[model samples]
Target: MHKRVHYAFTVKRNQKNLHHQLATLPRAKASVKFSDRTDTHGRLETRVVQAPAVSDLGVDFPHATQVAKIIRHRTQRKNGKRSRETVYAITDLTSRQASPEHIAKIARSQWTIQNRLHFVRPTAFAEDASKVRTGHGPDNMAALRSFAVNQLRATGRTNIAAGLRAMSYEPFRRPLDLLCLT
Candidate 1:
């Protein structure tokens, strides 16, 4: 059942790889193209997307219908630093099921998950810096951190850092009260 589900995945850039070949193709050869620019989180970013038909590539990706390339140019507002990145992806959806604009939206929306969940787990909860390497210790710690984050979000605490600080005063007692666990 999982194999039949439609999905998209980013392709790695490797020499002689199908994804790399697609990425190197000229923009004029693309079947669909889209570009946009935005200022997000104090950084200016321009994303140019190119999508080509999967059938033309002679590659065998199960249920694959389209290949896409995203070129991103980013500039930091404070440090004046600049960077460029090109990403490639393949999706099971055909051109009809997923248009270039729609695919771009899907690709860009992935960052929201990264920012809200992945980033907060590491930075706000200090999960990455933790040295709990014993059997089940890391997993248990991660679960506890996730529970805390969920509790904070559930209680309408928008600022996780502040919520953590507030809970740390009484440690065990405070969290139990916050969650009504007592």
Candidate 2:
């Protein structure tokens, strides 16, 4: 079974640039809620209201605390989304050998999956508008779409939607070779 544990932290407002940064950490599944607040200048301030338990740090709180420290420093000082300094906590549910770097990797990976896999595919491909909202249909079609995306990405087509569209438009061999189930 997968070892899982929880921790908590805060993400500051005004750091839109760091959304991807937090999502790429190790052992992070999902956040419960993210919200917006009002800043002193009356601009919109966004924060990570809740996140999943991060499990890739060591078994004890010390290691988890170290991860939090690194998150705080990195998010605050990073090149994007300049803000007054907001902090967010994560709880990593991971194995015994998980290191801080590993913890970070899990966090990053979670974000990548959410943004690159889920959000981008739907928005770019208009997957949500297919009207296949019933049992198994949407999911099945999504799986096929994901398969196509993986094939295109494997062939060096990085933009997922574009790749899908290209495959849709092309003639016999290349696109068929891409989507073929051999």
Candidate 3:
């Protein structure tokens, strides 16, 4: 935000008041609505995103410009199981800056971010088991782990756990080559 960058993120049910406020927004007045379907992981998924006309709502957030509702319907092709989910979101960008399509893309990109960065952190580095409870210790360690992850990624290592294991097998040689230290 300080960098003049805009952001759109989901408002989960944990934020009861905000979630309820967005949930009940009148869809009839939506400024833009977009829907898309795709097949992934043996499941056919559909997403419908609607952003209502910009209005001053009672939400206690800053720089908030638009609120949106995302309804997702998923069907597993293998088992015929089905599921539905509704999610709300807030964005600092106006409708002009972020169309419904862009907002929906942002929402979907979050899952990729979680899988590529967040999920690998704990799985590759044992971050959750670390005892770095002090103020700066945890933050610094996280930065180091992120650096390592990025370095491995730069070397085209998609499976970070396997990359870490392979790097360890060669001791300082493989890692030094990646760092251009050899």
Q: Pick the candidate with the highest TM-score.
A: 3
**Candidate 3 off by > 4 Å:** 1-3
Local accuracy of candidate 1 as per-residue lDDT tens digits, 1-182: 36657787767565447665666555565767889999989999998888877776665667777888888899999999999988877798888888777778888878877776668889897887899999999989888887888899899998889999999999979988998989
lDDT of each: 0.81, 0.52, 0.87
lDDT of 2 at 49: 36
Better of 1 and 3 by TM-score: 3
How much does each candidate deviate from the true structure in C-alpha RMSD? 3.8, 11.4, 2.6
Q: Candidate 2, residues 34-151: lDDT per residue as tens digits?
A: 3333343334344433344444433333334322323221222233455444344444333334444444454445656777678866887788689888899988999987776677
TM-score per model over all chains: 0.74, 0.47, 0.85
Tell me the lDDT of model 2 at 9: 37
The true-versus-predicted C-alpha distance at residue 59 of model 3, in Å, is 2.8
Better of 1 and 3 by lDDT: 3
Worst 10 residues of 2 by lDDT: 68-77
Off by over 4 Å in 1: 1-5, 11-29, 55-62, 77-81, 134-140
Task: Name the TM-score of candidate 1.
Answer: 0.74
**Residue pairs in clash, model 3:** none
The lDDT of model 2 is 0.52
